[model samples]
Target: MKPLNIFYAEPDADRWFKYDRYPRRLIRRIFRGPQRPGGVMMVAINLMKGLDRLNIPYRFNDYRYINKHPEELACIIGKPQVLFNREWKNPVLFGAGVFSHPIDHAKLFEQYPNLVKILVAGEWMRDMFEPYYGDKVQAWPVGIDTLHWAPQAIEKTHDFLIYDKTRWINEGLPQPFIEPLLQTLNKRGLSYRIIRYGSYNSDELKQKLHTSKAAIFLCEHETQGLAYQQMLATNTPVLAWDKGGYWLDPEYYPHRVQYSPVSSTSYWDARCGLKFSGHDDFEATLDTFMQNLHNYTPRDFILDDLTLEKCALKYVDIVKSISE
Candidate 1:
């Protein structure tokens, strides 16, 4: 069989437009071996690793060069805009969705059937898009690169950690979500640091997390929430919101509630971390998380459930199904 052709959009200046579906450049980490920092890049790298293990012949290229070559069976990651209003032999959209702004699917899909098959990182995403796209959407979790994110024999340096995006302060989570958590941490007299998503590269972040006891995650919404999984991969437990604000009523707490493509909860398993609705029971939740932190084996959970090899096999299966 011929190899699967994979195309990813090149990171460029113009790709950062208001509602473009291109990948954003996160922190660049100087790490040796099979792991890099960015979530999207890591997904690509792990997929490549899976293909290599299976001896599958494949080519990786920038989406810009896709039209320059002859048409054939191929898989596209990143932006699907390039494939729109055009024709191709067979195209697969892996981990594709709108990240920033709303999409007019009625107009876009009506214009061109660019996406033939689609794979998402979570079941919730599939549920949200399936009604509009029909039987084309499938749930395929992008598992973690365990080798790069596994736990180590390191001493704990801080009592707690706050893992979040830098944009949360400005755009995502406002004072309603932030102030209560900060007050709780301060009241407990815990030594903590807020590590923004883009602030540190993989190696740097790994080092910080290795020396931390626990983490609290704040984000707008998550399809897969790779960063939270990465923290879990390091055996550091997390406390995160259980529900997406999009489904919640706007009247009760309108400050941080925002729209999202899909509703997903990533860091609220009993074996990994804790969950909270709002400031109502946050203190109690924190108390429980702190009390049960030592018993949680989050790294083991990732190893068993979300390994890259497992995810790759699923990807291969989907490709085979679609190809056949």
Candidate 2:
């Protein structure tokens, strides 16, 4: 049988850029999709390459054509705030995180019973969606292109690279946690640089990761922690927070948003890196991290779990299972 036509949704144009000159830019025009300053765009681009490698025919954000033809597959690749219609017969939500409220997701699923599958980023998400969507939800984290993201033979530039995003403060993590952590690091006379969200583009970010010895990631929450994984892909050990935040009100900005004890969605480990619970835990772990940074072989963990080929093969299997 001929492969199904996969209509992949494109990332928001304004939120992303075209960095084709970068060596890491995967398959030309097709795989070279828009790039957000962060990891989301890279995830979309990698998935595009995976689709190409598997010979799955695809189009980006052109819903009119896919909508007109009911037989093709519609793949939503990011947070679906708008521009989605329940028109396609084989609709699959791939790598979607917590964009809508739980109640909203339930309504969408009920409205579109033809929705074949909802592939999310981690087991935590799978658990979140399973109760409402039943067996349709599955875990499918974004894969890494290890070829471009792997550890290099270059010299390490910084002792500790602080990967903190301002969004974390708004979304979940408060200043109490972040400010004190930074103060503690400064007091220890640690050499570090803080790279905020919009400070670097895709190529520059990759280059920065390659040069860094270690990182401290302070993000609110992630379905898969793509940036954290990217840091690990560079063999750069990371210390991340294990907790996350959620929306209780689901009505407004930071809508009833507050920190909650939640399961991590990444393949984090001592071998790759560490996760701290609070200020005390982080402070306690700092000494161990500095002393044995070399012992943490994060690149290997990423290679084993988050590689392009591995993700593509899994995607193909999922598609086949649904199509057949």
Candidate 3:
């Protein structure tokens, strides 16, 4: 039972303002509740939970322990700033949402050229980074907690749960894709519930999934769509907007970088459900998807590839692979 060194930090405390400090922060927490953690934070949280399930020994954010054992592998799952200030002696397994793009952090990559592995969520993301980082880049998605996301014994009150995470802003305009979809759903006399990405919490979404027959995921792309995966883990089929083409991040698209064949659902299979490109194909796809909805066994896919213990073991293997 060897121990593993893991480091993670986000919403870095040093960057907190006066209002975000001590008494004020405490008051805010009391009145407003603690702020919900974003995707990157969840990645670290889920990994630790997975490790715990396997009874794996691991030290979290224990920098002193890391300093003492420089020859050990240090898995840094987090904000790049944690690694920026100092040169690490340990072989590192850097995972999860560390960098948005390689162009933005060329110097960071250069500084830590010996990083055992630079992990992204999917193969498409790996392709985007491979040109710059070469063989050092690998795709490694975190596991989902199947027990938490399991199907509930509830009556399905709605036909679809519309999960809108379309991030591209149209400059003071409503989302282009959603309105039309809503209209079509109305015309078809379908019962559905709409939940915007940042507006709703996980519990609310979980309830919606339990009540809905299926989910409609409207996102441009996902490095690894945790929410959508959760929906699948709950045995809910998804009608995803998988407009596969060049990466469309405004920061690095046509002019800067043109990585192709990007997907809205990074980890998907036939068992998960259907995919439609946009308004054009959506109606037809929806009809077909609904017609064959009963056949989908999305939870099976999760059990096979992404159970908590399974992914934790994979992470252990990844860490062990790093050279001392």
Q: Which stretches of model 3 miss by more than 4 angstroms?
A: 13-28, 107-109, 169-175
Candidate 2 residues 1-324, lDDT tens each? Answer: 344444434433332447534444444435756545345556667877776766766677766676677665656666453325344565555445335434455666676666677777777666666777788788887688777777788887777778775353444655445788888888888877778766666577777777778888876566677777888888888877665555233363355333243444356766787777667788878877888878999888888888877887777677778777
lDDT-based ranking? 3, 1, 2
Q: List, residue by residue over 1-324, the lDDT tens digit for candidate 1.
A: 666777655344445576353233332222344334365556667787877766877878644455565455567655554355246645545454333222345343455455557666677666656666677767777677888888889999898778765233244555545777788889999888888766677777788889999888776567778888888999999888654546332332246433343343642357788887667888999998889889998888887788887777777778788767
| Model 2 / residue 288 / CA error / Å | 1.3
What's the best-to-worst order under TM-score? 3, 2, 1
Stretches of candidate 2 above 4 Å error?
10-40, 53-69, 79-83, 89-98, 166-176, 244-260, 263-265
Who wins the lDDT comparison? 3
- CA lDDT of 132 in candidate 3? 85
What ranges in model 1 sit over 4 Å off?
A: 11-38, 62-71, 85-87, 97-102, 107-110, 166-176, 247-264
For 240-259, candidate 3 gives per-residue lDDT tens digits of 99888878788888788888
**How does candidate 2 fare on TM-score?**
0.79
Clashes of each: 0, 0, 0
User: For every candidate structure, what is the RMSD over all alpha carbons to the true structure, in angstroms?
Assistant: 5.9, 6.5, 2.2
Our model 2 lands, by Cα RMSD against the true structure, at: 6.5
Model 3 scores a C-alpha lDDT of 0.86
lDDT of all the models against the reference? 0.67, 0.67, 0.86
